[model samples]
Target chain A: MTAVLTTTAMPPAATAPTALRRALPLLAAPVAFFVAFFAVPMVVVLSSSLAAGGAPSLANYARVLLDQYHWDVLAVTFRIAALTTLAVTLLGYPLAYYLVRVVSSNALRRSCVILLLLPLFTSNIVRSFGWMILLGRNGLVNDTLVGIGLLERPVRFLGTEMGIVIGLVYILLPFIVLAVGNALATVDPTLEEASADLGASPFTTFWTVTFPLCLPGLIAGVIMVFTLAASAYVTPALLSGGKITVFPMLIFQQYSTVFDVHYGGALSITLLVFTLVLVALAGRIGNGGGDRS
Target chain B: MIARVVLRIVAWAVMAYLILPLVVIVGASLTATSYLAFPPQGLTLAWYGRMLADTSYVAAFGTSTALALAATAGAVLLALPAALAIARHDFPGKRTLLSLLMSPLVLPHVVLGAALLQYCAALGLMRSFAALLVGHVVIVTPFVLRSVLPQLTPEQRALEEASADLGAGPFETFLLVVLPQIRGGLTSGAIFAFISSWINVELSIFNTTAELTTIPVKLFNYVQYTIDPVIAAVSSITIAVAAVTIVLLDLTVGLHVLSNRR
Candidate 1:
């Protein structure tokens, strides 16, 4: 996830107000800039998606929603993203826990952090290229598996969904690790110690106390990963070897080659709406779970 | 404990997975053979020399660097004052405005890129450097705002007020007091912004022409057609830049990730 689940958005809170008269000037440039470049572009996309032949119509969306091929593309994209999210969370949680709580040596921890970040800081093109090479027929992954007798021969991975999932997981794993590690670091050890002192088993204490407390971060990380995985273009484009198509690729094609702004606008808005609704639903679920705990 | 041992093993394995691709890329870049090879048949830097000889690669690198620098500088300039306004004062539509600023963080870049391509085309600036820079600035601004907002604590409000009481102008107070304290956050934020712009493809893809392509996009088109030692050399260079940037960030701002904040 080059577009990552960073500590980007903090929860808004109500604070004491001292609104200055100069606040308007401070806010003017940013508001205008965001409106002109960010907000207006989005609006234009929405309008284009809604229009057909110079009138506002649902024809573009009808083409997207009424088609089986489009549905298949959506299914493949979401399936890969879901699998990537599941794999990333499972693999990343342990590393986060180990780095945060287990490693006492500062030098080793720092080195590990650097290693984790190396891929994050690199471009998706380079990273997906690494996978393209490694997942090739004679590449390291296939070579190791065959050498170890786990496989009889090299398998086709480059054009397959498995390769895409593997690449997506690798790209997204660091986000989960960083997110969960941040959450784990902030947990009060005394609470866990108190639970153990009160005769709780380690497993019981972790399930009852620690996990719930970190659920919000876990959920946030999960949302970030899923959205990014769902909307990913570059990795799937490269790793899929043109044998697979994701939602974003469809959008890319419409705008880049087809020159169909109406159709591309519909696809863009469709992806945007789905992603936002999913995030809001996940946020609601996370909050409800937190309240119950 | 056995549990601890297993966790350590898993952690080390994951770390290895993270490093393996990078090692492969760097290793493959040096293969004396014409094709890519790991544990390279023999070490040579001929690919690096070849890549350097290609002026297109040189030009792309320059373009990417200049674009990232301009985008980052623009983000910091735009975001700092907004962060100050949001953190230091209360106003109407503040929450709405804040969400708008942060929306790009979650919004898919492909969608944004498509929108920009369409929008900029209407404005007759399609596929220009300005189009790419605006999109980059829009996306990177949120990062700087997020990082800097946390640094503008309420306790600093008193310091700022005292500066104002001493007849220090608003710009002077910002320079001497506000800037000094938030330097760490600003540095990390700017680094993140620069890297994000540097590495972006989905948005940059729409606005880039063959004459003004970024390094990532160049490597992208080249990689799709051929996987050669030269592409590996270019990728390795990007990885080296990343490693150097992270190390620099850690030394300067103390990345201090996964560490408890007391």
Candidate 2:
């Protein structure tokens, strides 16, 4: 399939590079605009990060990297992201399976999909606001817990890492469901039946066959969730109630409040590098999963 | 059988988790009390009325709508041409160019937003609508490109070539042969672009002021210090917009994202 796509997708691979001029008009506007706004601004940030007092220096990096506070913020940021990824995967996979393989009613599936997309389509602010209301000391979750005698009194959640994790998980769950559901929908069920015919139990079939087939999509969704969760500012900020701070908040404070672009630039570049490295690593993992499948 | 039953319960619980928050916001919006309340202490639409009465909320809504619309239009206009070039033609450094165009997807908005705040400040464009629109276009254009590039398959390229060979002009070939086939991609891409722009807070936060804020930014600011029924009403409005958009997308393009089509 890959070979066929590569061949047919490219007509006459040896075709002349002279055809480039024909694309000039089409590429001119988009390329120019990206260069001006996107490329130049990013370059400015990179250069500014390397400069202090009108001379290129590593002082900014020393300030950002040499500090224990920045490191602590990064650790907290990644810990929340990791936890959110785990929770979303644990919760999203079963729902995706049910939606794709179990439910036979088209109307029900459609409604499920719309409901799933409701939070996705809504703004993160609004979604986090919902959580803010629910996870408050007197909010629904607390009220239910206390009412059910599960807790002596309302435990504080709004200013804790637990609150942020729940909010981040909610914000990111849809991506996993969409990713895994689409993958599950394409898995040939006959293969599972064939595995059963070969004297495999349901658990064995799922572990040896069914699971590997969708591993690539699962990895993609996980990468997306982790990256988004790691970079997320709004959900963490809202749910943290100004008590807990993450990496992005540091960057925002530097820029929006501190007005220190040099330090802010270093923070921004740090995030960009970390995010890009993770994506690259995950791409390799996803490709390996594809080969195994 | 036990596993199946457990899976059903878990799936239903997950769906409930997803719906609970939005329902709480909507229900709270209707409370007759000044404070937000779910199961709404005496149902009323007065909060929504209050939102309308507050000119700032009204202005923020208008700004958000107009900004989203303009950004979506800009993204489509920019990305359609770029996708055409990348998919329809083979050029030097095509892969690098494509990656550059799509890098915003991975780049954090806070980073990009800060970068723009600094860059625009140097160019005297800080806190301006132009600055916001440019950042939005950079981010959302990738959506348009990703959707449209797949539609411009080799077979579709062949059709374009065939039309040109059959004495059709370039504009005619694009308008007559290309546009109709990619309309679905365009619609889905545009909707995604518009919603992304509308919901954006990180990028807009740097550029928006009290008077120039988008709806999401306004609500974000309001929610931090205060949680009122009017805030619930405003949030409920965004949820409504999301629902309407999703329904429209389902009706028009068939949101078969999880279907077995691929």
What does DockQ give for each predicted structure?
Answer: 0.57, 0.58
Q: Report the lDDT of model 1 for residue B4.
A: 80
Give the clashing residue pairs of candidate 1, or none.
A1-A171
Off by over 4 Å in 1: A1-21
lDDT of 2 at A158: 93
Per-residue CA lDDT of candidate 2, range B72-126, in tens?
9999999998888787667898999999998888789999999999999999999
TM-score of 1: 0.96
Model 1 per-residue lDDT tens digits across residues B1-262: 7888888899889998888888999999999999999879899999999999999999999999999999999999989989987886677788999999998988999999999999999999999999999999999999999999998896876787777678776667778988999999899999999999999988899999999999999988888899899999999999999988998899899888898664
Clashing residue pair totals per candidate (backbone < 3 A): 1, 0
DockQ of candidate 2 relative to the true structure: 0.58
Q: C-alpha displacement of A167 in model 2, angstroms?
A: 0.2
Q: Report residue B85 deviation for candidate 2 (angstroms).
A: 1.2
